[model samples]
Target chain A: MKLDRRAFLGTATAATATLAAPAVMGSARPHVVVIGGGSGGATAARYIASGAEGAIDVTLIEPSRMYYTCYFSNLYMGGFWDFDNLGHDYGNVALLGVNIIHDWAIGVDRDAKTVTLASGPSLSYDKLVVAPGIDFVDDAVPGWDVSKQSLMPHAYKSGTQAQLLKHQIENMREGGTYCMVAPPNPYRCPPGPYERISMVAHVLSERNPTAKILIVDPKENFSKQGLFEEGWARHYPGMVERIGPDFGGDRVEVRPDDMEVIIDGQTQNVDVCNVIPAQKAGKIAELAGLTNDAGWAPVMPADMRSRMDEDVFVLGDASHQGAMPKSGFSANSQATVVANVIRGELTGSRIFPARYSNTCWSLIATNDGVKVGAAYEPGEDQIESVSSFISQTGEDAELRRQTYEESIGWYNGIVDDIFG
Target chain B: MPKLTFSSILLAGALLAPAGVFAQATPIGDAEAGAQVYQRECASCHQIGEGALHRIGPHLNRIFDRRAGSYEEFRYSEALSRQGRDGLRWDLARLHAYIENPRALVSGTRMAYRGLRDEKRRADLIAYIRAYSDQPQNIPEASPTALRAEVELSEETLAIEGDAEFGAFLSAECTTCHQRSGDHAGIPGIVGWPQEDFVVAMHAYKQELRPHAVMQSVAQRLDEEEIAALAAYFENLGN
Candidate 1:
């Protein structure tokens, strides 16, 4: 769990091995080429290689050398975590005998069972795990595109954009208005927007108490709505206001040059505008013809295997599985299941029935955390929730503190579970 | 019909020689059933096996006859620490009662679990805990007073209708660890399992016949129909 010098050495060795040979040398070993070394893909690659005990070859294809988790980036905004804490290298994952390729997976040739990378030889695979995470729908918010990202950062992808958003929030003039255009339902991290708002409020509450936060949300209700509202009331009274769909929250447009957000056709100049646009599966999944009209991949509940292709498994935010939210925890949990299933299929290891679980923890303020968790089993059509538990609205401060501590522990545990 | 081994008797004698706490009878409960209970309820907080680390709760290796709050590495609640200071050893009766309701025995205890209400299930869980003792063969017999019939469901009992769709939705909590597909590592997979088996297992956890705290808590929340629904859903999943 500790990232010490020895761990760094281990990663260096693995990276050296990967660069030396783009494709694994053993032709007899089943190759698992994973796209997107985020939570799902990295966990899958690690688990498959470790579970197989070198019986199979795993080549993880991710363009980035470092992964910034979207999970706790909100905490980073709130100054609870540093930028370095959100970033992780694949050294630990590579240590598990996985070929960590830092290149884009441009295309997947299903007929040939090969993955064409942006700058490397096409890698062949017996099984492929696509966990490309979410890509914003172009023009999801009218007049918004990648070019205007610097002007109005989405900060949804959790790396440079997040830093940019943080920088903008920090530099906002005193008493300035911070406006957020929330994404619609079925976006990554159902509660993420709200949590981010809370974090921003936390920062603003300390720095510029006179500042205002306005949320123009598309949905009538959001995840943990009551808890968040209660926390906002208690912590930052009169400072935060939300406009739901009834008040034209969905009908909003932005002019990046003017730094103005128009809600219900009323243009308001704001110091900072966070526009989280509509989202879909990453482009690679679509390019591979794995996605449906919904812009997400349909996966079987049994093992997260793609409905379109049996050998290809889709996971995380990109997968259109029933009930489970498109959160990091859900993706990691799914990755473990997929890894085990794929390992069982390839290595002839002991395969058991699939079970899944996820818990989402949000910090309403410092030392104030709430969580919702559930256990699930595969159903006839989709993965289902058997039972669930969530933090109550009127929980005491001591319990909230404990919940926050638990979240910290969980963050450490999950990162270890995935990267290690 | 049961043969008492010499080592078991010797263990029983050694255990009884000092405390004379346990009733001189054979521990009669299903270890397998106890394992299920332990996994669902106790595994998260307590560890009983080799190299078990002290988690939220203390490691419980050879806990039988050990003084309360005596695990060297664990920081006990004041109530439990005081009980240990008073030389209160954990006998079968006390351990059973404590697990059924930790706060009842030692008020203000930090253990979050509510008491296990089912007496028969408590005995089975104790038997399972007893099996992990260093000299498990030496543990005394379970008290007859706590004994009850093993829960069994007939075809008619399992005939409770369930909707797979609803069951799938309800199973999200279970799948948090069980996984819908793949190697469970330590956790077992529940997919493609028979409906009857799933129902029985869930019922066992629900009824406190199993020792796992989490599973017991999950099962206790479900009705027979809900359990049946989950069973139906998992039964038809995977190959």
Candidate 2:
């Protein structure tokens, strides 16, 4: 296999180090291994490598060559955004002296300070950052599994599933019902399911106005509930309906074979079913023994360091940090704090106090966007929201349009920040 | 008469001067001409007389010597707001430059007017607006006499040397929305800004003098030294 300059140097250094004492390894540059190159992992890897300026080595292992963000997938479904715009590559990220490996990281050997790859080689690291985003819990939704994903798509993870779901929506029978099975609390993107419902309504209102939409939500309340309810009432009136946990929304079971939803012991036929199951940390974190009984990796509020392993940091949706929602913005924020702490530990870089913030924007209809945001600070037990703001229900159209335009701007800014 | 010194002579002249004359400075242009200019140019979007409330733009009352975007209730464009936070006050020189060409002073200002090109007309308009402001002798803290030293930055705070390395680390948070490459679509670019402008703008956000939620949240957590470091780092970035 052809090797790059850094890889050749690493190999040569390894060979030379075999003849020297084990203590010589301490003198080498500290190596940071980052797993899962989404918002959290990618930002952390970029910051640590760029901030160190050749003082430390970083290797990022991600399975996919192109990362499709989940943040704007709903917009894509709504025909408001281009699907191609959701994809970003690591070409610029690799330029900052990081070893970018497009391979799966299968196991973590924490005691040995090494990570095993799906391809056969085991790479060693001084510190490891696990940012694998999320995995659906088994049997969280009865009669549903990943194998049945083609029949009833989750469309949650970033990939072809979003495309499949959009295709299904487009090809749906005229005047047919579209039912959604929303997940419980503590999921990625709190307003995501409602936003998806809005997008579905937007598409159907144009194609088949008679088509009805049903939501099976387990939570009592959702993010931007008032704003969304008002928009739905005004924009797509009588087209959508919702059932909360109090009304048997909590009792849900999906049958992909027959395309039916069983809610409150009542069977309803649907043309398209979107099932978003309860989630947990990605499987690799569990393999690393970093997850707790709740199937999430608990982290220190200050730095997002794994409570189990000081050298390992868990970020993004997989991390159970308090107050901050599991979002791309929050992940990016936490990654900056993680990068600063890690760089300061390895090299003598100045470590600033940890600060985190997050803002989530959602679109109800064309030029009708709403946002909720909070500033976070580390409290005694967890990260707490210091200040927060949400869009008002009765805001004028001009403000909503401005908010939508700002969301577009934010998308451009964040993608540039992440990929570059 | 009794061996009066220069100070005593000046004091006698001041005492003999007409009351309320020294309360206001000499108008830069004819007030009557300026009133005509205001009617012709600015009457549609702005109002300057007593009891003027916010219209399309903020009410121009007390606008002189006020921070650029400090009329917090109004929804100004991000570009104008950023400049205001960057220590752009409505003084004679700055207001002159702005009225001459709004875009030249602040790029992406949402002021739809092209600009007043005639130097005489712009001065007249500014003189008319300056009538609404409290005189310098009345409000010393916010007066046109304080030019570059308008904002509340102590000499010691400005003197603190910034560490570029630390700034680079902190800038990652900012760059999540504000591009480092100076490509600003909706959010304004912060790259290559003057260090003092950056510091002053950040302090404005920290103090809630500027009105942007994300910016305020980001700035509130940063200390004085961190702000300086970020200012230094962004100032050195190649656009």
Which candidate leads in lDDT? 2
Give me the runs in candidate 1 sitting further than 4 Å from their true place: A1-19, B1-96, B99-239
Tens-digit per-residue lDDT, B116-176, candidate 2: 8787787667666766765443221124632232135678888878899788877877888
- Tell me the tens digit of each residue's lDDT in model 2 across A60-133: 98999999999999999999999999999999998887778777889998987778778666667778999999
Task: Give the lDDT of residue A339 in candidate 2.
Answer: 92
lDDT of 1 by residue, A269-374 (tens): 9999999999999999999999999899999999999999999999999999988889888898898788878988988765656767778899999899988777
TM-score of chain A of each: 0.95, 0.94
Tens-digit lDDT track of model 1 for B1-239: 12333345555566555455444544545565777888888888888766877889987777876778777678888657655643456666567657776654555479999878676677667777765555533535432223332344567768887778557555544554465553344334568876866776676556554443345557876778788988888888665
TM-score of each: 0.68, 0.79
DockQ of prediction 2: 0.30
Task: List lDDT for all candidates, in order.
Answer: 0.79, 0.83
